[model samples]
Target: MSTDQFTFTVSKTDGTARTGEIRMPRGVIRTPAFMPVGTAGTVKAMYPDQVKALGADVVLGNTYHLMLRPGAERVAQLGGLHQFMNWPYPILTDSGGFQVMSLAALRKIDETGVTFQSHIDGSTHVMTPERSIEIQGLLGSDIQMQLDECVKLPCSDDVAEKAMRLSLRWAERCKVAFGDQPGKAMFGIVQGGAVEALRIESAIQLAALDLKGYAIGGLAVGEPQDVMLRMIETVEPHLPKTKPRYLMGVGTPDDIVEAVRRGVDMFDCVMPTRAGRHGQVFTRHGRLNMRNARHAEDTRPLDAESKCAASNAYSRAYLHHLVRSNEILGMMLLTWNNLAYYQELMAGLRKAISEGRLADHIAEVKEGWAKGERDGVVEPIDDKAIAAED
Candidate 1:
């Protein structure tokens, strides 16, 4: 466990599924890892210690947001993102390419880079691959992504090919800009929309650069789950087996399970935290709407078996009241619960993969979700309490 250099070791594999460790100087990331999105230096409503306690080995920092606000230079001056955010574990950073592309109307892309108006202040900025790498460096990212154009799916093959080629070019620039970093990595992103040939070609080309790792981008961005899986299948075959594979911006629990089955090693998404803020919570029994009236009189905890306090200690009735009343604590509790569940799922995946029973584990997990919440007797609301409130 001496991790002075960046390394990825697959400890076990079940068919295409894998269990592994990505050893960085800062810490070790368990493969099939789900990095909670900590965009703008925070994972929304949870504390850094809580995020770590929930079993996340790494958290994702948003290059676009961090570079725009607080500024990369400022973060570096403030002793990098780990010190700035107080999360000392591994921090992976996106290249800011997706956020730039998301600003479709406000941005223009060229061979050089993306020139766009900032969403925060409408100020103009340009992001080249080299600058993206530079920004990630300033943030002290352990795992940094290459700047690549991620086109929305269902586009023409011609458009897909164009973007894929452009991304390949950008990948080269990012690699060169990243230079030599002992315990850090700059991952190349595979982008080809839904075109199989383009995806294969992109993967093959990026694998040639032989970056520290690879990420499958341009997926889960409005594409059907089947299509996304198809893209993963196509790209996974062409990429180097020894390197880690990350599927970016993916997804629900089902999506993670499917992608892991197809050989993805790392993942990041905003679904869990975002869903929590909206009064939704994901559990072993699937997603539940805490805002629903059905939970108004339920005394049952979200999951009594869960090690998460929010899930085991709080009653559905109380959670329902908090969410309905729009209390901030409800958002924090639900967010914590969701992240805990996701990490638990990841731990399960690693164990199942090691045991050579990933398929069985996935089936059981899906079954629990399909079975939904168990039926429970509702506790009667006290009439005197209700009368007093009225």
Candidate 2:
């Protein structure tokens, strides 16, 4: 560990909104950070260097995917995930708890751990809180999440309470297993389904652990938007304001903005990249679908102001053709555009919070998206102009 040594220091605050940085051996991560999901060791279509250029301070990897495909031991043997994936920056790895429940089949959960068949090849595996820590350590992750049971939203009161309590016990075991890794930290996940009281209890218990950070888990798993916000509100006051707060698998540009206003610090979601693969791209004005027929003739960039070349250099008409033809560049460019938009949004939130104008900033962002439309017709790109640029 460096002098920073796995710490979060708050620089400024705006109501529930605040700005800060998390210091790790890998680097310093700006608060209100949006971490792109690098499932199975890559961030889908975008390369690691491109993801870095997009201003991301960190990225997330799934233990379930890596352990299933390449195996954690193999990754460790190959000089850890950073060398293996060519990403030298910080990486946060999930504990394999959530994916096991959601993706795996024939799952059996007990006090010790969960045993399930892999979704990929139907291979058998067991993931306990200790083993989850071991796998993350093998991957050399900077931030490691505890293996907590994530009950789906809308579970009965009895079931929610049961899972929440179980997760608390598992958190303790994960803490012990994580055991004093310098420059690295273990984060306890708060899981309580949609129950406000249960969410509070979970947060209270995890905060007492003096963990390096905390995460709001078991949400965005089919709950309504307001319900998820309510859960955050219920848990925020109970968590220590000093530790970094992560909202796991929760998302969208709007969701990130609202969650920042509610005191959450970090976020990881598949929405941006996943949407990109399907021809959807996000912009300051609004979202765009390249697969639409009207875009066949329109000639405009996704956003002229965006620093990313993909957003400013390529025209919508070109993107439309690529997506329509199922070209690989379509996925790459859109994924690039979407991730750039998310990182841009996070930067805006940080700046607004530091300036004590987060509320006004949030309103402005939403209004821009609400009042505009990307549907107006425009003349096609001139062949001569396109050829000259190329």
- Deviation of model 1 at 208, angstroms: 0.6
Where does model 1 exceed 4 Å of error?
373-390
Error of 1 at 312 (Å): 0.4
Clashes found in each candidate (C-alpha, N, C closer than 3 A): 0, 0
lDDT of 1 by residue, 40-105 (tens): 999999999999999999999989989988999999999999999999899999999988888534
- Residue pairs whose backbone atoms clash in candidate 1: none
Each model's lDDT comes to 0.90, 0.90
User: In candidate 2, residue 8 scores what lDDT?
Assistant: 94
**357-389 per-residue lDDT for model 2 (tens digits):** 999999999888876553442223222332222
Worst 10 residues of 1 by lDDT: 381-390
